[model samples]
Target chain A: MANLVNYYIQFIKRDLQLAVRQKHEFVLPLLFFVLILILFPVTVGPESGLLARLAPAVGWINLILSLLIALPRMFSEDYENGWLEQVFLAAVSPSFFILTRILSFWLLYCLPLVICSVLLVPFMSLPFDIWWVLAQTLFLGSLLVAALGSVASALLVASRKGSGVLALLLLPMLIPALIFGSAVIEAAQQSLPYLSPMLLLAALAVFCLTIAPVAAAQAIKINLG
Target chain B: MFKWLHPYAKPERAYALANRLYLWLWPLALIGLFTGSLWGLMFAPSDYQQSDSFRIMYIHVPAAIWSMGIYMSMGIAGICALVWQMRSFELSVLAMAPIGAVFTAIALFTGSFWGKPMWGTWWVWDARLTSELILLFLYLGVFALFYSFDDKRAGAKAACILAIIGMINVPIIHYSVEWWNSLHQGASITKFDKPSIAKEMLWPLLINIFSCLLLFIALTCYRFATELLASESHRKWVTKIIQ
Candidate 1:
């Protein structure tokens, strides 16, 4: 157990080092998130009331699109560089390797989105109370996206042309997260005291956390074979 | 029993069993489809609320049920492929993709046909309809993934992983109507106690469902045979089976 924890710590530390060295990959999704939010009001016209009304959906859309853009890069670099192959051949179980990879990805890909969500709030005319709700929902919901992304990445790890199909496969499964996350913020906007949607979002997070690593591990084995 | 079944995992035996079953299945499927459609389309009583539009249920419901049903089967086949390293199971999953996609498309089409008169729109963002659309995409993704790679074994592995991941969506699709406050109605027939529909309606629906099941079996068998032939084209079995 101590060895497992040490392995995770090392994995996370290495991932952080990589993230710091190659900061563009981490920053791009955040930039995309802001750009999408900015484009929405311009596309829909500059009415604060209208923007406020559509804030929850806008936030949800930005979250999903940003995640989609970030997904292909999650494993493509590791797979291409043969780092993943080394991991597969390592002493660590594939399941543990995948879990550690997903954790690192969640930290790099999703944590930025949570920070960006705070910046996106004012542009959408989001209420101060709902900003916290959106932050919480995005944080929880991004974990689900990271988990699902891990499975998708593992599945497509071997394919030359995998990104397009990965999006088609992963996006549909994200509907539940999209719905629950958007609903929480929408409820907050309405001053409806939105706990149910947040609770559901947490449930989705728990579900994804439990199942995705095993699926991802299996996918990696198949792809490696 | 397990020993007896093990031989059929071999391509040659599977092809032989499929060949024999194909002859029998065609006739039964024809009879079932003809009688079932007649009973469902002509004889079933009109819904008190939906009138003739609900007749679409005869086709749509069965197709929808099979769409989910076949996906689960594919996932199981995938698990078998992954765990037991069964190439035949992988081939079966590849074969089922197009058939499942077809069923999902039919379900979605018939659903829209039903929805037009009932809901006054051809499409709605209802939970069931949305989930069914997602299922179709899942099927298409699997099919596309399998054919995308030049390496057949690699393609099959990729698709198998995809099948398992997509399986998570199946239960979500099934329960989306119940979980979300959407325009789609909840299940009427899946309940254990009794179905919500009248006996007259239920009987024909069951017949239609049976007919669809037979059709799916026939289609899957035909597809599996074709896949086996393609994969084993250089083998002695292909020459024997073709001749």
Candidate 2:
């Protein structure tokens, strides 16, 4: 049991180290998130009511799409570096490796977006009171994104052309998150009871957290073979 | 445990069994489908509210049910293939996807036709319809993922993972959409009242349901047989059968 914990820590450390080595990979999704925030107003025109109405959807979508941008790199880099093979052959189980990878990804890819979204909330002219709800939704919502994207990344690890198919596979599964995340903010904006949607989002995040890694690990084994 | 049934788990035995089953399934499917459609279209009473337009229910509802039913069956097959390493179940997943996709499409198309008259629009973001649309996309994802890999078995395993993921998501999608729909439309979709299903209307619907299910089974068996043959084409058994 101690050995498994050590292996888990080592995997997380290695992944965080790799993430830190290429700082831009971590920053790119954040940058993309910011860019979309700027671009939506330009494309849709600078009307505060429209932007306010669109804010929840725009924020949720950009977060999910930016997560997609970060996803393909999740497993492909390890596979290309031949690190995944070594990790699989080690005493650490694939599920643990995958779970740790998803955790690091949620930290690296999702956490920054959650923080940035809080800052971006004012720019969209959404009510300041809803900011906390928006932040909460973004935080929980993107964990589900990270978890589902992990499975997509694991499955597509060996494919040369993967990003397109990954989006197709992951986006449909991400709809619940999209619905709940945006709905929470929408509910809050309308002064309705928003707790239900928030709880649903957290539930979804937990469900994905438990199931995705094992499925992803199985996918990785299949892709490896 | 049915120990005596173990031999049927072999691909050759399964393939042979599927082939034998096809003989009865195909003719029964045809008869049921033709009679059910004819009876439902002509004999069954028109809905008092919608009249002739409601006849589309015979196709739309059955197609909707089978599309979801096929995906659920395929998901179960996927579990067997991935967890137990069953080749026949792998073949079952491969065979079921396209059929499920087609049924989903038929449901969507017929749904639009039905909606145009009932709702005075070609589309509504109703919960059932949106959920079925998402189901179509899920089926397409499995197809795309399965074919993307150069290694057939690897592709199957990858697709199986997706199938399992989708199975978990299906109910969540359905419930979420239902909630969203009710929030937006508010009690407009309570048309599925079980007590309102008169005996005259219910019998034809039941007949059509059975026919559609039989058709799905027949199509899946046929597709599974051909898929098995194609995959095992280089084997001695395949060559002997061809000879």
Candidate 3:
């Protein structure tokens, strides 16, 4: 068990190291998130009321787009460099490997989006309470997205046109998460009860965390075989 | 039984079975479809409120039920493929995609046709309609994923994973009306205590639903046979059966 913990920590460190090396790829999703958020204000006019009304939706859309932009490279780098096979043949179980990979992805891809969500909160003229709700929902929802992404990445690792097909398969499944997350923030803005949406978002996160690693592990075995 | 089932996992044997099955199914499907359609369209009583517009239930209800049923079937086929590593199961999943898509589309069209006369608009963001649209997208996504890969095995694996994950959406779609306050009426035919529809209406609805189910079975068998043949055209079974 201690060894498994070490493996996870090491995996995260290695991913962080790689992110440092490929700084451009790491920054691209952040830039895309900002650009997308900026589009709403420009397109919908600079009216504060309209922007506030659209804020939760804008944040949710950016969260999805950022995840998509970051998803293709989640496993491609290791798969291309033959590191994934090494991990498969290692002493670690496939589940452990998948869990570590998903955690690292959430840390790298989603954590930044959460920060960006905070930064963009003022642009949308969002209330403090709604901003808090958006932040919480984004954190949970992005974790779920990252878990689902690991499964998609593992499944598509060996396929041609894997990335595009991955997005097509994954984006539709992301709808419920998007709806729940955005709805929570929307509920907050209206000063209505936000508990139901938050609980739903958390349930989705738990569901993804429970099932995705196992599915992803199976996918990794299939790809390696 | 397992041994007997094992042999049919081979594409050729599956193809042969599907071919034989289709021969029996097509005739019965035609009989059921023709008989059901004639009865439902003409003999079924008109609604007290909506009149003949409720006749659309013959098509709408069956297609809606099938839209969910086919997804469940596809998900089961996917699980079977993953567990047994059967190529035939993968082919079934593939064949089910377009059939499921067609059923979902028919459900949506018939739903709108029913809705326009009843709801005074062709479309609304009501739970049933919204979820049905999502179901169509799910089918399209599965088909898109199936064709996206160059290798058949890899494609099947990816699509199987997708079908399994997307299964979560199915329950949400089915129960969306109950869970949320929506304009769409809850299940009238499927309820337990007593179905809301009268016996005169109920009989035709059941017949139509049965016919639709038979048609789906016939179509899936035919499509599975075609897929098996296409994928394994050079096999000895193909040479023996076609010639």
Candidate 4:
């Protein structure tokens, strides 16, 4: 058990180290989030009320879309260089490798976006009271993205084209997370009971956590043969 | 558990089974469709309120229900394909996607037609309607995925994986949409009292629903046979059948 844990820890460490080496991989989604959220305020006119009203939804969508932007990059390197092939050849389980990859992705791709979303809370004219709810939902919601994104990245490994099919495959699956996460924000905005949506979001993330890695491993093996 | 049914796992047996079943199913489906449509369209009493507009429900409701039903079946077929590596089940997964998509489209069109008169709008983002739209998108995603692969087998497998994901997420999508809709709009959707459907209206509706199911299965069988032919075209049985 200790050996298994240590083995997976190295995979996670390797992935995080790779992200750290490229530092821009971490900054890209965050930059996209800020730039696009800024565009919304500028384009929609300077009205605080509309910006505040649109804040939760607009925030959630940009976060999701920017994460979509970061998706193809997630696996293209390892897939093209045959790193995945070497891992599978070593008889290391693909699911463990995939789960740790997703965990590091959550750290690199989703974590920064969630943190930046909290920082930009003021720019969107969001209610200060909703930040905690917003952050909690973003944190949970993006983990679901990492899970689903792992499956999609695995899928992309099999398919020939990189055209926006990743977005098509991942976006629809993320609707529940989007709806649940946004509900948490909106409920907090109105000061209504928000606990249920928050809990549901966590449940959803947990559910995806169990299924996605296995499914992703399956996708990889299907293509491998 | 599935050991006794092992014979049919061969592509030839599965194809022959579908071919034979479709032959019987076609007649039943046609008769049910003809009689049910005639009765529902002309003989079934017009609703007390909104009169004939409610008749659209006969088609709309059945299509709506079965779109969801076909999606469930596809999910099962997908599991069969991925887990058991059943080649025939893979054909069914591919065959069923377009059918499910068409059913979802019919439901949406009929729904808007009904909505125009009943709800005073051509469309509304009601929870059910929105979820149905999402279902249509899921079908399209599976359909598109299948075509995108060079190896049809790989395509089927990938599409099946997607179908499984959709099945898991569909309920969560529906519930979350419902919760979100409730937050925006307060109980504005008109409720249909199901037990109140009259016997005259109910009978034809039931008939139509049954006919639609038979027709859907028949079409799936037909599609399965044709696709099985394509996939097995190089085999002796296929050449023999072609002869």
Report the error of model 1 at residue B57, Å.
Answer: 2.7
In every candidate, what fraction of the native interface contacts is reproduced? 0.52, 0.65, 0.41, 0.61
- Pairs in steric clash, model 3: none
- Residue range with the least summed lDDT across 10 consecutive positions in model 3 chain A: A178-187
Candidate 2: segments with Cα more than 4 A from true spot:
A1-5
- Residue A172 of model 3: what lDDT? 67
Q: TM-score each candidate.
A: 0.92, 0.95, 0.93, 0.94
**Residue ranges of candidate 4 with Cα displaced over 4 Å:** A24-26, B1-4
Report the C-alpha lDDT of model 3 over A53-155, residue by residue, as the tens digit: 8887788778887888888778777888999889888888878788888888888889988888875657878776677788889899899899888887777
Candidate 3 wrong stretches, greater than 4 Å: B3-7, B172-195
> With candidate 4 superimposed using the best TM-score fit, by how many Å does residue B175's alpha carbon deviate from the native?
2.4
How much is the lDDT of residue B161 in candidate 2?
82
lDDT of 2: 0.86
lDDT of 2 by residue, A1-225 (tens): 888788778877888898899888778989999998999899999889998888878778888888888899899988998989998898777898888889888888899898888755678887767877888888898888899999999999998778899999998998888778767887887889999889999999998899988889889988888
Residue A183 deviation, candidate 4, in Å? Answer: 2.0
The 10-residue segment of model 2 chain B with minimum total lDDT is: B186-195
The candidates' interface RMSDs, in order, read 1.8, 0.8, 2.6, 1.3
The sequence of per-residue lDDT tens digits that candidate 3 reaches over residues B163-188 is 88778666754453334423234543
Output the better candidate (2/3) by lDDT.
2
